[model samples]
Target: MTEVRKGRTAKRAASRAVKRRALAIAADGALILYFLFALFPVVWMVILSLKPANELFSTYFSFTPTLDSYRTVLGAGEDEGVPFVRFFVNSLVVSLGAVGLSLVIGLPAAYAAARWRFRGSENLMFTLLSFRFAPELTVIIPLFVLYQQLGLFDTYVGMIWVLQLVTLPLIVWIMRSYFADLSPELEQAALLDGYTRKQAFFRVALPLVKPGIAAVSLLAFIFAWNNFVFPLILTSSEAQTVTVGALSFLGGDRPKYNLTAAAALVSVIPPLLLALTIQRYLVRGLSFGAVKS
Candidate 1:
């Protein structure tokens, strides 16, 4: 009886081990497939950007890579037709402006929502979310009319204000959650030690959650930087963003595929660089409130 029991136990353990190994292998395969799906478009973009104009639609998959497209897009060519640098500067300005405005508005709102048990706080937060989720087109026409009437049409300030809608709710919601997860005890202790509420927040709470703040700022910056529609209809040449500028490659006569790809590559660089630089903060910020002491 003992010998039979031992044999059965060994068989069950072996079966369980095999099952675990199979599950792990399946998971790894799925991840690889997902990674490929996500990366293929980026690879294709790089290939198209590098290919010379003549080879753009060639049947052969192979082509000699050249810097002509990049040079043209970067305004390194003799003609300097494309105002890539100007568009880049405009995007940077708008992105920074949006981030500054959102943080200014969102931080206090988030702090109040987290710390105060005010009447209808939940409703207010939900209302903010509703605005956030609403389609941009729905508001665009009204905004356009209003801006035009108010003499804000085709202005940088108008575009920045419009982008605030994109960045504000995200900042408020994320910061509020982070603040809520943080213990009030820390603030209270600081207060007891003679620090004012504002001082306590700035000195104690803010410093500790610097990672979350950095993450939120980075996210806000990226959203504003990449926004296409607002800049598309809101402003013309004077305040055009990289997204709109990139579209210039597609004219009425013909599509400049190589130039478009090059423009796209140029548009992608700043945000990608920012993301890479602040990736650590992003991870830390996202993981905030995920664990408990």
Candidate 2:
């Protein structure tokens, strides 16, 4: 009887090990396929950007690598009137401003929603989410007219405000969930120790959710930076962002594929750099609700 029990336990353990190995193999295969799908276009774009203009359309497909395309896009040598620098600066300003504004407004609103049970709070949150999901084009005409009347058309302020609609609701929802997952006892203890509500929030609560804040800020910045339609309709040369400026590659006769590819690669650098910098915080924030304490 003792030998039979030992034999049964050994068989079960071997079966479990086999199942685990199978699962790992499946997961690895999925990850590799996903990585290829995600990275192929970016790899192709970089390859195209490195090719010379004449080679871009040549019959034999010249494989010669050159820096001329990058120089043109960066205004390094021959390309003088491209306005790359202005567009790049404008993108930074608008993206940062939009993210800052969203945090200022959304963080407080999220805190309220998470900590307090106000009337119609759920309805308000849903309304905000609805607005976030709505198509940007639907509101563009109305906003264009309004901005014209208010003299905000073709201005950085107007562009930033319009982008807030894209980012604010996402910030509120993400931060609110993070705040909810935190222990209320910490804030209560701070209050008992004579910390004002605002003080407790700024000192205790905010620090605890720094990961969430960073993630939301990164998301908001990306949204505003990549925004094309709002800037396309509302801005001209003065406030044009990298996205709108990239369209300059299109002319009456033919599209400058080499220049556009170079411009696209340049445009991708800032966001790529930012994502790499904040990748750790992003991972933590995304995993906020994955496990329960």
Candidate 3:
């Protein structure tokens, strides 16, 4: 009887192990399918960018690949080919400027909102956040008129200012939470150590939330970079960004799909590189202060 019971127990353990293995396989297969689905468009765009104009319409994959499309998109010289490089520069300036301005202003505002109970604080935060939810189209017409009046249209400063609508609220809200999650005791200790309020923030609180800042800054930069409607209407050429400039290929008598694809791939490089460099901080930033100790 004892031997029979032992054999039965062994069989049950093996059955459970087999079931676990099947579940794990299913989960991995599902994840793989999702990744393929998500990456299909990017992969197809890369293939399109490699094809020459002559073979762009070819249904078969036997055609030779060429770099002519990229050359056309990037231009032979700074002033020779398309102005895509200029547009790329404009994007960098405006996006970086917007994110920089938001950090400078929003960091203090977030810290204040987190640590203090000023009157109308909630209302003020809500007002800032409301900008995010409001559709850009609702105000773009008036904003365009204002930009024109102020001579801000097609200017770098104007683009950065308008993009505050995109970057500011995100930094404030997310960083506010990070600040709130921090213990007041730390700052109190800083004060006891003879640090002024400003010094306490810069020396004590700021370093603690560096991860959140990196994550939020990356997000703000992406938002500013990808903004299309503001640049499309507010700027013509001088301040135009890659989002609007890339579409130029679709104009004229004939569409240049290869050039368009190449432009897109080139534009993606900066943000991709930035994300890759700071990806280590992203997970920690997002998850920090999420749970109580």
Candidate 4:
């Protein structure tokens, strides 16, 4: 009777193990399907960009691939009419400029808001946060007229200044949280060691939050880089970024889908490369102060 019971138990355990393996395989397959579904549009864009102009509308996967679209966008090939290089460079300058200005202005502001307790300080911080939730369209018309009257139309200064609306609040709010998460005891210890308040901030607090700065700066840059409304309305030619410049490929009598696809894919490279390069800092920054232990 004992021998028979042991044999039955072993057989049941083997059957249960096989079922668990099958379930694991099914779950993995489902996750893979979801990933592919999410990635399909990007994959399609790459494929379309690689296809020659003649094969752009081809239904099947047998189309010939060429570098003509990329060449044209980069100003090295047959199509020289559109200066994509200028547009791309403009984006880099404008995005970096906006983020730089935001850091300069927002960092001190965030630290103050974090450390001080002035009357109406909460109201002031809330007011700054409110700017982000307000839609850009509501104020663009007034801003448009204002920029025109002030001689700031279609200029780098105008675009970078205006993007402060997008980047500033984000930096201030996130950095405020980072500063708050830090224990005041650290700065106090520095103070006891003969460091002035300013010195404490620069030598102690600032160094500690470097990862957070890296993470938030990248976020701000991505937002500023992808901004459409400000650049679309404010810039006509000289300072137009890739967000608007990509549309130029479709401007003529007939839209060139291949060129448009090529422009977009090329435009994605810089931001993608930046995110990949600083991914470690970004991860650390994001996870900063998430757990006490």
Candidate 5:
């Protein structure tokens, strides 16, 4: 009787183990499929970028690859390749400047909104957030007029200022949540220990939210970098970002799809590198305050 029971128990354990392995395999298969789905566009973009102009419209996957497309887009292969390098630099400058200014202004604003209650503070924060909800087209014409009058049109300063509409609210809202998740007692303790309010913020409160800062700054930078409508309408050449400049290839007689693809892949490098550099902090920042003890 005892031997029979032991054999039955062993069979049941083996069955459960087989089921668990099958489930794990199914989950991994699903993940791999999703990853491929997400990566297909990028793969296709790369393939498009590699194909020579003649091969661009070919339906078949097999192709002779060449670097001419990349060289042309970089201004080395063509005499007048639309100044893509300049546009790339403009994107970097404008995006960085926007993020920098947002950090300077939004950090304090977020901390203030998180830590204190003042008259109209809610209204003020809501008003700032409302900028995100409204479509940019609604205000672009007025802004165009204003930029023309103020002589901010096609200037780096103008692009950065306009991008505050994209960057500032994100920083303020996300960092405000970070600040709120923090215990005020930490800052209060710093104050009691002879730290000024400003010092407490810089030393105690700020360091605690470093992960959030890194994450939000990356997001703000990407938003600023990808913005197209503002740059397209506001700037002609001097400060046109890659988003607008990439379209320049489409201007000449035949649309240079190969050059456009190469330009796009090149433009993706900065934000991709930035994300990889700070990926650790990004995960922590996103997960922070998601759960409570």
Candidate 6:
């Protein structure tokens, strides 16, 4: 009887283990399918970019690949295209600039929001987040008129300033949460050691959240970099970023899908490289910020 009881228990445990493994396998299979579905368009675009213009529409997978589209966009081919390098630079500058400005302003604001609460504090934070919820188009027309009036149209400074809408709220809210998660006792201890509040923040509390800052900054930069409607209506040639510049290949004489694909792929390089380089810091930041102290 004892031996039979032990055998039954072992069989039940083995059956449960099999079910768990089966469930895990099913979940992984679903995730893989989703990844492939999401990646299909990107792969197709890359293939289109590599194919010769004449071969672009001929077949999906059976075409002679060429570098002519890349060469054209980069100004190495006989057929000239937009100066994509300039657009790439403009994107880098505007995205980085907006994120920098947001950090300078939003960091302190986030700290204040995290550390203290005054009247209308919740309302004010709500107002900041509201910027994220509102459609850019709702304000773009008025902004266009205002930009023209203020001589901000098609200017780097203007582009960076406009992107505050994208970066500022994100930085403030995320950093606010991170700062809140950190224990106030750490900063208080520094204050007792004769450090000023500012010094305590700069020397003690700030260093602890480095991971969160790096992750959020990278995210904000990507958002600013990928913004399309802003560049489309706000900038022309002089200050346009890659988001708009890549589309230029699709215009005039005849549509150039191959070159458009190449330009699109080229534009992805900056964000992808940046994300890869900072991936470790981003992961660290996320992990560190998640735990409440």
Error of 5 at 3 (Å): 11
RMSD of every prediction: 3.1, 4.5, 2.7, 2.5, 2.8, 3.0
Q: For residues 1-293, what per-residue lDDT tens digits would candidate 6 score against the true structure?
A: 99999999999999999999999999999999999999999999989899997887778899988988888887753255578878888998899999999999999899999999989998999899999889999999999999999999999999999999999999999899899998999999999999999998899878988888899998898899999999999998899999998888788987889988998998888888988988988888877665221
Candidate 5 residue 170 C-alpha distance from true site, Å: 0.4
lDDT of each: 0.84, 0.84, 0.90, 0.88, 0.91, 0.89
Q: Candidate 6, residue 4: CA error in Å?
A: 12
Off by over 4 Å in 1: 1-27, 76-81, 290-293
Cα TM-score of candidate 4:
0.92
Top TM-score hit: 4
Q: For residues 118-164, write the lDDT of model 4, one tens digit per residue.
A: 88988888888888889999989999999999999999999999999
Q: Kindly give the stretch of ten consecutive residues in candidate 3 with the minimal lDDT sum.
A: 73-82
Tell me how candidate 2 scores on lDDT. 0.84
lDDT (tens digit, per residue) of candidate 5 on 165-283:
99999899889989999999998899899999999999999999999999999999999999989999999989999999988888878888888889999999999999999999999
Which stretch of 10 consecutive residues in model 4 shows the poorest summed lDDT?
Answer: 75-84
Which runs of model 2 end up more than 4 angstroms from their true locations?
A: 1-38, 59-62, 76-81, 290-293
- The count of backbone overlaps in candidate 4 is 0
Clashes of each: 0, 0, 0, 0, 0, 1
Clashes of 2: 0
lDDT, residue 73, candidate 5: 81
RMSD to the native, candidate 6? 3.0
Q: Put down candidate 1 lDDT per residue, 1-293, tens digits, no spaces.
A: 99999999999999999999999999999999999999988788888888887888883458999889988887652254568778888999989898898988898788888899767878888899777799899999989889889988777888888998999998888888888888999999999999999998889888877788888898888888888888888887888899888878777566777887788888877888887988888788878854211
Worst window of 10 by summed lDDT in candidate 1:
75-84
- 150-187, model 3: which lDDT tens digit per residue? 99999999999999999999999999999999899999
Superpose all Cα atoms of candidate 3 onto the true structure and report the RMSD in Å to 1 decimal. 2.7
Displacement of residue 108 (Cα, Å) in model 4 is 1.1
lDDT of 1 at 34: 100
In Å, residue 21's CA in model 3 sits off its true spot by 3.3
What's the TM-score of each model vs. the native?
A: 0.88, 0.85, 0.90, 0.92, 0.89, 0.89
